[model samples]
Target chain A: MPERRSQRSIGGLTRRQVLGAALGAAALGAVGFRPRTAGAAQPPIRIGFCVPLTGPYGSEAQDQVRCAQLAVREFNASGGLNGRKAELLVRDSKLSPDEAATRTLELIENEHVDFVAGSLSASVQLAVNNITKQHRILYNSISQSDAINEPKDFSRYTFHEALNPTMTTDAVGRYAFPRFGKRVVFLLPDYAYGHEMTRGFKRVGKEFGIEVLSEIRHPLGTTDFSVFFPRIRALKPDVLVCCNFGRDQQITLKQATDFGLKRAMKIVYPILLYTARLAVGPRAYQGVVGGTSYYWGLEKTVPAAKQFNDRYRAAYGGRVPSDYGAFGYAGVRTILASVRQAGSVETDAVIRRMEALHYDFYKGPEYYRACDHQAVQSVLIVESKPAPADNQFDVFKILEVYGPNRVHLRSCRELGYS
Target chain B: MAALTPELLALQLLVGLALGAIYVLLAFGLSLIFGMLTVVNFAHGAFYMLGAYVAFAVAGLTGNFWLCLACAPVVLGLIGYGVERFLVSPLYGRGIDYPLLLTFGLSYVLVEAVRIIFGKQGYPFDSPAALAGSVEILGNYFPLYRLFVVAATGTIVLALWLFVEWTNFGLIIRAGARDPEILRVLGIDVGRVWRLVFALGTAIAAMAGVLAAPLQGVTPEMGDSMLIESFVVTVVGGMGSLGGAVLAGLLVGLVVSLTSVVAPELAKLSIYALMAAVLLIRPQGLFGRAGLLG
Candidate 1:
């Protein structure tokens, strides 16, 4: 018993051993930070945001949530809308159309959200569009659906904040026409967005004296793109444009490289924005030019853009401004301006304010277009630049900027909008 | 009549191989599960997602991609084995509907678990830096990463094929599948063999996930879409035949791709239609052993 007690005694303690144990504890303590409590508020205004909270577009969904929250935060800090506090009501649609429709009803009835917002998934957006129309409530849709602006699908209640596919490609066609020499091969996704975008590309491509050589629609999630490559290779167009979003965009670009499509012909991506950049490093995305709503370094041209960039960076702890985030941030700004114009949270008043008025939205050209209640914002044409260090969204040189007036849309009647 | 360059063909074939590889892995699991137990294992897709997430965490901690890839199957195999031992073993002599119900429930639970853990965001995993660039063939640029996917899947399939056909354990597994009770009469433990087969099948599915983590977007609900497709392949290939699965996988890939040139919306549903056609013609599947590819 005496020997056992002696053996248990600390006889050979080393400075290194003692230091190691102390360091381990210190490291764990350093990692654990104290959280702050949120201050209580009274009668907060609820703004419902229905996005793909659990699907392929979850990242974009999160951005939408943050932007809405940030706007609500700023609104409250700056004495809120009409001196009333604002709180966002977020519901995940899981990127399903039916679910989005259900969530829209829930948000409208159960959550009692004063205003409704668009989701990340275009399908969800369409669902919300129908639901919001039935309710005759305001729908500030960020869906890439031109149907929102189309007199046929457009409602007295629905207003679009983002660019339509036609609007997006209209600018690209105008800016890249002369430089790109317009021999185009369309590699569009085989879906509604793809079809609309293809139609838009061809419409503008033809106007700019660009020949539409050949068109091939690739399925949204096709793993092997080999079949499409042969067609593109055969055509050898001056510009090969791939109009696919999300993972499809990244995969297309990577696969295009492997097929040597770049060497044969100059490749043009209609849009290579945020989500694609994060999945594929900036270094891998070099030599590509695409359009965007805004960029952080683009403050000098827009004047009021710098404030947005600075505030957004501050809020997100200096995370770079992604297209989705900017869309969210600017969307909130648009809604705020409209809400101010409306003077009250009367849904009809807000819709009228959005539909009738045109204001200088600092994001891009013409700010907001009264023609369709869609932003006639500036689209930045940037070329990707390879980086020395790997970073998400580290790409592109700003090639050209196209404003809304320059990138005009054929009236709702022309587009069968009615 | 058609312009198909060497580089173009290479790229297309590489794409085919990559898709085929995924099919091989997917089909192998489907085949083995159906072969040994006569159950489709609809939850196989969930297991695949688990393997990917597991690889992701392990890779992040150790910065060892190969190690993550190697060990994912082992962990998944153990999990599959456990599932068989407890949840599945009781239903072994019972009706097939019971296991089907159990697996369907298990799939939902697995998906919900992933949702809880990963927070529904598409977790992006970068491909290994060693093979990230594009490879050119016939003036068409294709990703080397896809090529690597092809190589890896081919190797795994070949190894699996060899293991099942040549190895003594493989013989026992096959024999056990044919008549599990008879193997018991021969002093062999049929339960252990069944467990091994189940684990082996699941391990293949898990390895498929490890390969896909970099290539495909990872999400909690990713399994929902893939489960249906894997079933389509299994049904098309005639359930229990490994070769049938690979062939049907390529055929399905081509159909999906080529159809995009015409009708995009029905590109997915075409597989079901094909399965219907096959069922109407050869109900046992082209390779399944007389309705055994259940």
Candidate 2:
């Protein structure tokens, strides 16, 4: 028979007694432990990125994520926020406002992110802003929308990194009206973005003695533009201002080219995306002129642009960053810089820091206007190259550059900020 | 609004015909599959999208649009035959819902697989150089490529009519559709006829996709909206009726074009309104026989 073994004792105490003593010491140590201070072993700061990772804008959204990733990498390489590295938590907005809200709530409530940024659709960004506003989280909107800058959608935490439709229209109208006649017809997608673009064009048109021939509003994502071609041709306008985005823009441009509408009127898209141009190919987009937030061609003049393009190309398989993608880079870069400048991720501190920041990150001089938190930045008027160039990224030729100024922006009083 | 002149009206009618041609190509395929197999193919659109991608690949390799056009239908037809034989044929004895559900799942799988193989970004497919420019018609400029589409659709319609109405194989197809058990008793392989019908349907859809590639760039989701619209076309034309599909396609296109002239926002909604109207008046559809579904 095996002998019965008693519990081993240590230091003249029974095993249970020693274990209880050790547990008590551990409890005491746990109670005494405190989190490390800033600059110590702190957790990485999280920025919840909400964008349309699916739907028609999937490619553009992927590019945005790539640009944001580059921004995060640069931030961490430069010792992000006092040695606390920055991290991105990405969630698909799905290009739907309701989906964006749900995903954003998950990001804040479950993931516990410090800030939120992203959105390609104007309406979708507004949805995200509403959620971020209620939660008191700083949100840098990277999509173009004039409605978001109005008092109805404005908040202390809201900062628009992209140029609003008003700014884009002003730049395009001022440049194109003098070059391509003042008689214009507007083919706009029926949405907040389209309506805002029309408002801006009409406002700018008044200054150029523009005769508004007709304004054709089609449903968003209209694949067949054949029905509207007859009407547009009947109007016979000198300039056709197409205010559509993503797939809508691509289809409209291609169909319009097929119908030979480009032969009659000079087509001017308010915001011509680099991705859209690539999707439509040289033949469809050839000779089309529009305003862009950023173009790789700007690297020829701006040192910062050159640096950004070089870094982006080196990291992303030699493909230049797109215009919408550049907004992602600028938004994340500026927000992270604000966090560093404030020395904290506190909402109020970051807001204050962002408000005072005069940044020349990827593009030329840019600053957030105090009234509406809209970024005042340069708008590049670019014309699509008529033929395929040696460098594929050389899709556009910079016709003119409108420098950063409030001249194109609505006044503080107009924004109901007085 | 621009004044609607006689010339403008004529031009709009031509445009409607061109638009209807695409809808007919898509709807006929759906109608054929439903008529022969009684399977509501939710993957019809996916097949269409696959056709466009295949065409894009073929064109890239050979740099010939005509060759790609010929290759897309053959490739899609083979794929359809395999799918029908392996995936769909086994579920014939089961309720129709089984095949319907299976096809619905298959659609998503195909779209995702395409996305994986070809990046999410769309690729441009320019029209052939011969059809690149617009021709002046009725005192207005109209796309020559669109005219070609109309002519091609008319030819397909006539060919399909002759094949279905006059050919011995077509008589067997009709006989099998009416009573497959009777046809089986006569030593005919009804299953083979159904598989061929399914393959033919998918091939037609793929052909439509090849034609549409230039009008809209090739993308994974290109067939999604087209599929939904074509379903409405199939139902309004009388499900399983080729003649009905052609008529309904044109009618829907006309309604959309006319509504767009008055209220552009209602263009898309107009087609659904037409479907609802048709369903309310004649539930079996314009050309459908009553008690067919019952």
Candidate 3:
């Protein structure tokens, strides 16, 4: 009845009541509002890169650093993780385990970084892993050591961005042994990684019906390999596998060329570095079969990789990106993506999000396995070939790509990783 | 174990001789420096690295491997002259440890400096086109570059021996090694002689570096193993005898090379074993004078 009095009238409604309703609405609007000003309230996410910037691995470290910087730059340019800018703080590990530990701890305790990356040497990475694990900081290792993924060395916070020795050996050995010959000789560096690599090749090689005729574990950083060359020559194996790295790899390969080892049999490198190949020369490296995680020439086939290579060349004054650089770039990208997916930067949250994550950054479909934290991706079996006159970085032609399921070990459970 | 075939033995012997030649170059320089200065220049290895880097740079700029070889020793010799005059002159009266410590510190500085300049990656100066291939000898294939290395080293050692044995400068250097104080009293500038000998020793080490440039790619730390090997040569050969150093270099090289064929793990230890054997039998070494043993 009173409805007829005034359907549109604010009967008994006070001015203060209306004002209170408007005020509540305004407060709700303010609560939901986002300023879109580059995450003004949150601090920059910092990543500590503990690399050998001034030691035996300094140049390789520098290349990795450049790639990492490119990754950070791209990430920041595209409205960084959760709209927060990313920062990379580089510290030189100096190729010493103690120094690597010291620098890693400094980054964790002093600099308060969210994650850590970049160590070319396995020893340095292992040293850093201990520190990062204690602090529960995520460590993305660029070093290729199977020891890194061993149950005894495994940590939930650690992830290997690069291939392990087993992966490398599997990727290269399967292809090399069948084509070259079954009788292979090894020149391993006398260190943990070198030993693991030998074990890796032997473990995988046995499945391929390959026999290791002999192996020489030379001291790390040997200046002259002339002594071993004659031994290798005399052994007259069907394949000569070199497991040395850094300067040792360069010297051994050059001396191998000098000794005409290639003339006698196939000279295969399980883990070949671009810098080493360049030092050994294209003429020598040609016809050499090896496995690398990535090469810039693949940019032609992979659009994402091409994008990365284009930007990298533009930024680096036309210097092509090496596999080491790719590892560093992908490593940072993987960590940041985990943070994006988890919607938080908490170490446990991001690590949980990272496990079993399927992502691709330039390279083909890659995933960080939940078990061992090893990045499972396509291993590119490349044969070093002469580059076209127009291009210097086109040193390799990708012969085949092996999926993670094929090359990666299923022994994580046995190694104690849950 | 497989029996060594004749071909294998010949190849091993050739490699042993090549390895010995490099050791000789390194050890001879250490012997000269130790004899005249009474101060072991641990930095001698650093000088060798400088020579390699300089040669690499020269080869890169000029595209002439021979020019790199020719210029490296000269540049390093001049550097050694300056280093001896400025750094080593004041420490002559001090104990041998002072100069040794100075050179040790210098080694660190030089290695770090080279790392800063050239980086950790090695730069390859490929063996010249003429020497890139192998040569067949007695059913075994030997790298021509290696054969060249052996020949060059042999010639240099012979020339060095003749100079030390025949030249007046060599006589003064030999005399200075025995008694610098007596030489000073004999109206000879013992300090100048020491400086010249130090420079010569450094030049020889540099020459070894230049030769090694193609054999082993040039890296900042390339000389580290060489330094240790040279020390072993000095100890195994008499402390200050050039001919003893040569003999020990060849002996160590052979032992290391042959052992590596059958037992690689023992290759490094074999050199120390030889050193121990020498120490136990003849403290003065194969060609060392008994007086120098003191």
Candidate 4:
């Protein structure tokens, strides 16, 4: 009797009619209606990271991605710019300029990344900068390049997180010139990066009254440094400044040691990579003094550095981040921080926030120069440890910490900025 | 610029000879394989790289450079044997292209496998303690390891010459190289001869890899440039000619070293120029027999 009554009308409607109406409302709710919550309403912020993931710097690129991922994770955990989570879309730049441009375009046009970051090679970074500039997307370059800061290439959207060649060479030269000697010789790889490094060194050398003995331009990827060894030894300079990078740096340093050039002259690199030091081992790299953007040894004095290192170690199998890897973390973190400060992902708002923001995210206090958008940061003068330490990562001993004010970066006017 | 002193000139000459020794070892293997199998081993560089990786692994485990040197060749020889039997044997009589393609593909597979196992980073392999530092020579310092390399290559060359010229197995190899049909008619197992020749060639390449590892660290792509350079040496020395490989390797080394002094940019190009000039004059190569591949 109850079932029959239910099957009959409820007021003016049957039970089946009432049930159908409720089901239709539920389906509509499932399809369209939703609560406007901060976390649920907004999509994740996408950052396109293009790096040399398939070339000589592939290992470094892998470390960069790992550090960037840590940055994104940290951002999301910290409420994520008003409850909008962050995500990363990585693409292999292939250490080629054209390839980097193509990948950056894809990131902008198809993937619709809110911000762009990464590139290890100087030329490749410039190429990425051009693409991001055209699209009006914010780009944070995490590579050492003088060209990226030049007025010809600089744009409002471009932010260089890594130190330029000028800053690095200045730090190294200031520390090394008076100590090592006045006479310097350069073995440069024939490329833009090498050329820029040599230029920076020469600029710094002029200030210290150092004599440049000779500049030998070797082909990129020259495995045999034997032919150049005799030429270098004959020069007998007080310091041999090798302006090569990655595999070139490793081979040249190893061969230089083998040829006994280290016996006569001091070997100084503008920037000695942590990964390169690890790859070449202590014997080849030891006693070689150079400038670095970040050394995890800063953890002893800098609390921020200790925090970053601890988080990184916990995430990456107890391995500390390399100098280049730190750049990746800083690049992504700064971009997201700017978004949080601006309270929106709008390009202009983020740009304004970044320009005004002074941060000590990893190493120490750093601020973007308004004219060129270059990160003015501290450079550490470090020497390769003479022997392997208990911790393999403890390869470099910090000789001096040159703060941003001590490190001479090129002025905007000097860079042709009006 | 530093003056090209007589002492520096003499030192450069020694460097050229040292560089040539590596090319000769690599080219000799390529020539031997081509001589016996009539198949261009495009994977020669991969075998060389694997040899270095194997040497690195052995050296890491045992801490003995000499032991690593010995083990690399043995490991590579076994690998070469397996590759010939399972992968390459079926492609026989299908023309040179098939094996060449197969080996090319094999080279990529091997490189990828190494990349996956070892990672893309290069690892340093220190020279033996005895050869760690440089010795003063010709009024300049030269790495003791380079001198050791030259001496080692000379000894290897002499032993290889003796084995090929004096032994019965060498006779069978020579017969197989010239005419497998005749070797088959004489009741010899030509397939076994081919397999042995391939193994010997790969082992020699592996030895060269071990020798070069200390000079340049071991990496997955370490064999890439060596492969191209060795191919140039093989072609310039004349295809399938061991003596030609030796002579042409030294010649190419001298040309590259001397060119580097004047124009470092053109140093790599000088080798190709030498090849093109030689081909224009004699298409068969310096020691290659006429109409072999044609």
Look at candidate 4 and give me any clashing residue pairs. Answer: none
TM-scores, all candidates, are 0.87, 0.92, 0.90, 0.91
Residue-by-residue lDDT tens digits, candidate 4, A265-355? 9999988988888877877887899989999999999988999999888766677888998999999999999999999999999999999
lDDT of each residue in A1-418, candidate 1, tens digit only: 2212211221112212222322332243245321112453444555667677565566666666556655656776787666766655556687678988987897787656678876765556778989888888777777676666776666777777777778788887777777777788887777677788888888888778888877777666554455566667766688888887766676667656655677777777667666566656654366777777666657766766766666656665565566775676556656666787788788777767776666654465444455566766667787877644754344567788776656666675675644
Best by lDDT: 4
Chain A (candidate 2) TM-score to true chain A: 0.89
Model 1 spans > 4 angstroms off: A1-42, A121-123, A221-224, A355-368, A388-394, A412-418, B1-14, B133-136, B139-143, B254-270
Task: For candidate 4, report its TM-score.
Answer: 0.91
User: Could you tell me the TM-score of chain A in candidate 1?
Assistant: 0.83
The all-Cα superposition gives candidate 3 an RMSD in Å to the true structure of 13.4
DockQ of each: 0.33, 0.35, 0.25, 0.32
Question: In model 2 chain A, where is the ten-residue run with the lowest total lDDT?
Answer: A1-10
Best by TM-score: 2
List residue ranges in candidate 3 displaced over 4 A. A1-43, A54-56, A81-83, B289-294
Instruction: Judge candidate 1 at residue A2 and give its lDDT.
Output: 20
Regions of candidate 2 where Cα sits further than 4 Å from its true position: A1-40, A387-389
CA displacement after TM-score superposition, residue A383 of candidate 3 (Å): 0.8
